[model samples]
Target: MITLFGVGCLVFLVVCALVVARTRDLLAATVVFAAYSLVMALVWQQLQSPDVAITEAALGAGITSLLFLLAIGRTRRTEDEEG
Candidate 1:
């Protein structure tokens, strides 16, 4: 029952995962992780779980990204003052 689009999304998910893992910059990794979460939300929608998709989109992509950005901003300022 797997379609081509599903396969493509899966491949993209793997690539995003690798990029997030290899990236050393926290901000860059957070952006990529957000993208990965959005794609995962799409995958969940494709799998017919609209509730999970909505949750992932809201919590994983939206709130988590915002929280990570806030944390990065605070830590960067602290590091700058110390260095």
Candidate 2:
């Protein structure tokens, strides 16, 4: 029962996942990962799971991305101090 829009979202999600995995930059990877999460949330919504979609949007795309960014920043600072 998948529509064209749903298929498109699936494709986009896969592409984003691949990009996140292949990217060398941590920040870029994190951003791509967040995008993937957002797409996933959309898919969940289309599937009629509003609660799961909201949770994914809030945690996966929001707090998780913020945490990754902060961690990356801290790691960069540590590397700078060591080198």
Candidate 3:
């Protein structure tokens, strides 16, 4: 029997992917993208690749999300000024 935690994580990953695709706000999408990283890390842990999973958590959930949010912040000003 598949653990519910595993199933929920898998479902969450799919949902996050869809959220990222459908979200209109850049900040919201970046947050969902970060959620995708976290879900991927959980999947990696389930697969026994703790090292890779840790790296993904740091890069995908941490660094990449911060970078995207920062970029969005920078660009928001430009968009606002133009509009």
Candidate 4:
């Protein structure tokens, strides 16, 4: 049986995915993506995979987010047509 908490986490994950896809702002999208990664880490933890959870938290949420933020800082925040 699926637990209520699991369902809630799944729902939140989907919502975060949609928000990340729809948002044009790179910074906002990156923030949401980080949140999604953190939740994914939590899910991995609940699945009895502490190794995967720690790796995901460190790499997915931490290193990846930092790289994205650094890239965004050096580029345009939004994609706009340039003539």
Candidate 5:
């Protein structure tokens, strides 16, 4: 049963990756990419890999996201529509 769950998470991760790829909005794509990392981290935790989970949380969910957001700052934002 757990194997099925792991498989499902893998499939969902793939879908999230596709979503990130297909999105034209940089911010939206970044958010989707973060979701992909978070889900992957959970999957790793469930598979008895706490070290991977911690690394994913610290790097994937934290530093990587901050860096991506910083990079995405070069793009226009919804708030800019008012100007």
Candidate 6:
């Protein structure tokens, strides 16, 4: 019994994943990845798993994304220094 809302979310998830994979810009990709995490959290919530959703929102969307941004900043600094 897959509803339209579920299908829409799945489509959006796939689209975001594709964008993240295809984009060359690290910052843009990171933002898209965060969006993908949020979509995943929403899917988990819809599936009746509040715990998983909250964990995904906190870790996946929040902490992991922040780490990635920080790493990207470091890499960019190193590249700028080298160049």
Q: Per-candidate RMSD vs. true structure? A: 3.8, 3.9, 3.6, 2.1, 5.0, 3.9
For model 4, name the residue pairs that clash.
none
Taking all chains together, each candidate's TM-score versus the true structure is 0.89, 0.89, 0.84, 0.90, 0.78, 0.87
Alpha-carbon runs more than 4 Å astray in model 4: 81-83
**Highest TM-score model number:** 4
The 0-to-1 C-alpha lDDT of every candidate, in the order given, reads 0.91, 0.89, 0.87, 0.89, 0.83, 0.89
Off by more than 4 A, model 3: 77-83
How well is each residue in 1-83 modelled by candidate 6, as lDDT tens digits?
A: 67889899999999999998776778888999999999999999889999999999999999999999999988852223233
RMSD in Å for model 5: 5.0
Can you list the residue pairs that collide in candidate 1? none
For candidate 2, write residues 32-70 as lDDT tens digits: 899999999999999999999999999999999999999
Best by lDDT: 1
Steric collisions counted per model: 0, 0, 0, 0, 0, 0
- Give the Å shift of residue 73 in candidate 6: 0.6
Better of 2 and 5 by TM-score: 2
lDDT of 4: 0.89
Better of 2 and 6 by TM-score: 2
Query: 1-83 in candidate 1: lDDT tens per residue?
Result: 89999999999999999998776677888999999999999999999999999999999999999999999988862223333
Question: Measured by C-alpha RMSD in angstroms, how accurate is candidate 3?
Answer: 3.6
Tens-place lDDT digits, model 5, residues 1-83: 48888888999999999988766677887788888899899998998999999999889978898898997786564334344
Once fitted onto the true fold, the runs of candidate 6 whose alpha carbons sit more than 4 angstroms away are: 77-83
Better of 3 and 4 by TM-score: 4
Per-residue CA lDDT of model 4 for 21-55, tens digit only, reads 88888899999999999999888877789999999
Q: Considering summed lDDT, which 10 consecutive residues are worst modelled in model 2?
A: 74-83
Clashing pairs in 6: none
lDDT of 4 at 45: 76
Residue range 48-83, candidate 3, lDDT tens digits: 899999999999999999999889977862224333
